[model samples]
Target: MKSELYYNQDRKRRLFVDLWKEQTPFVDNENWTPPPLGSRFHFYVSSRQELKKTFGGWRTNETNYGFNNLSYDYGYYNSNPIPLQPNNDTFKFRLSSYNVNGVYGPIIIDMGTIETLNFAFFSGSGNINSGGVPSTPAFSINYYTP
Candidate 1:
């Protein structure tokens, strides 16, 4: 269910963009190979949409899933399914663990769970490191328009 935490059109600009800097590596360090789609997903932002932009060094496992907020917390929602990038293109970012260059995701977010923002290059398999080759960074100034 949606919440009262939304803003009207004119008020919508008051909403801010959400950006994550560090994310899980798209491939394993051993051989830099991407797993199949639906192999994994990541949850973003432990709290509501209260920051200008977030640099995620945190994990999905840390957030309490009981909380719920979209317009205010997660900062993103999709009516139609997000289109997956073609030709193995993905958003480039850094690895959370090593702080080195890492490429993964166009950052697919699932707003269905109102408790937290779910992120994964692929949709639902739980395998991990399944992102493709890098083309762009997920947050290039206007990643989200609020």
Candidate 2:
């Protein structure tokens, strides 16, 4: 997924990653393949950071879920939306294992406008033909900025 930024004054920000995955099948063949189903999941911001410059910098929002003990249920992650403060008008984003594994994004995003309402970025992964595998999934982000 591509990193995006909004153009507005600072206010408040909260983020959640919704992941719909296809469980990879055991079978592998040139002519036939199985699709990953029943894997529509979301990670409600388990851990976040003002920056990923160091391991000590990260703050864990929820103790029950982490990279070690991953849960398929939505109740494991944090759902309560509290306005998050960005550091230096910048948000250090790293989506790890979103999991059996979570998604760790190795991307940096400049904090966008806060006042502008409705629609920032929307991304959907996987397809009917089983496009994305477990290791590397395929997704695209629809970006809009006012």
Candidate 3:
């Protein structure tokens, strides 16, 4: 396989924009959109919002919604999904791995070399079982690979 390692330092790039929460089960019909990719990126998720519906009415809380106010200490959340460019007018594999830290500039890579690229956000165990109200604190990513 022929490929370049580092990113392109010439083309200007844009980093992460904002963080968002992923609806559980991934089938709730709730979807999120992430910003474009560049060179450097970084995402930290601390807290999230949990929308609930009690007997009285409906409400939203930050107990363990699924990635609300992300922080660097708790863990790192991608915040956005990296989109891969098209190849010969056709979309190829997915690009994940670099966090919000790798979307600041053009990450020039040798085209038609690698098969695929993938990335994911990682959260530590510090806020996994805090036992708040939502029962779980998770960081999620919403993206389109086409």
> In TM-score terms, which candidate is top?
3
Worst 10 residues of 1 by lDDT: 124-133
Look at candidate 2 and tell me the lDDT of residue 144. 26
Give the local distance difference test score of model 3.
Answer: 0.26
The best candidate by lDDT is 3
TM-score of each: 0.17, 0.19, 0.22
Worst ten in a row by lDDT for model 2: 127-136
- Candidate 3 regions with alpha-carbon error over 4 angstroms: 1-38, 61-124, 128-146
Candidate 2 lDDT, tens digit per residue, 1-146? 24222111221222222332222223333443444222222122222211222346533221111222122211111122223222232222233342322334322222222211122232333210100111222233332222
CA lDDT of each prediction against the hidden true structure = 0.25, 0.24, 0.26
**Candidate 1, clashing residue pairs?**
38-125, 39-126, 39-127, 42-119, 48-73, 49-73
Q: Please provide, for model 3 over 42-136, each residue's C-alpha lDDT reduced to its tens digit, 9 standing for 90 to 100.
A: 33222222233456664532231122232221122233334432233222222222222212122222112211123232222211111123233
Off by over 4 Å in 2: 1-88, 101-136
Candidates ranked, most accurate by lDDT first: 3, 1, 2
